[model samples]
Target: MVKCNTMPEVRSEIDRIDRELVRLLAERQTYIEQAGAIKGERSAVRDEARIEDVVAKVLAEAERAGLSPAIAEPLWRLLIEKSIEHEFTVFDEKKKKIASA
Candidate 1:
């Protein structure tokens, strides 16, 4: 835990954490890409069962981390939605390549 005595320090630490969060999101995206590769259709990109499972896990983790589920749920929902969009793009591009080949 970092203790900050000034606004500049607090802002700087927040910025640093934001950067780390983005990096982790990027890392998670690699697995999402892998999922796209393994899936047979764009429709598979949005798995309601998986979404519920993920949200459950995220909610649990947020509770453990002392974060509000109110915040985590919506944020994770948006992330999942954007990820599905990315997976659809990846799926379509792969389909195009296969068709071309």
Candidate 2:
């Protein structure tokens, strides 16, 4: 929604889009939680290649939408890293079970 003309007319629309991103991130986290449950004792919660795939796919969409790919990449990278951390914490179930045995 960035005004390619540098006008403020598109600012509100951009803000709306940003809010949508927040909601989408929340939705994505819910799915990540489910993935953790399904991983079930696997010590590794993240696949780096999968993250790369995500970034690549998102960047492609951004480009197609005429948004700056540069702006999107770092934003998604931070999101992906946070997801990995959240998933990894739950994966300690495997570690704990191994230790207690």
Worst 10 residues of 2 by lDDT: 1-10
Tell me the tens digit of each residue's lDDT in model 1 across 1-101: 69999999999999999999999999999998888888997777888999999999999999999999999999999999999998888888889999999
The local distance difference test score of model 2 is: 0.81
The number of the candidate with the highest lDDT is 1
lDDT tens per residue, model 2, 16-74: 88899899888998888778767855655778789899999999999999879889999
**Stretches of candidate 1 exceeding 4 Å from the true structure:** none
Clashes of each: 0, 0
C-alpha TM-scores of all predictions: 0.96, 0.71
Estimate the lDDT of model 1. Answer: 0.93
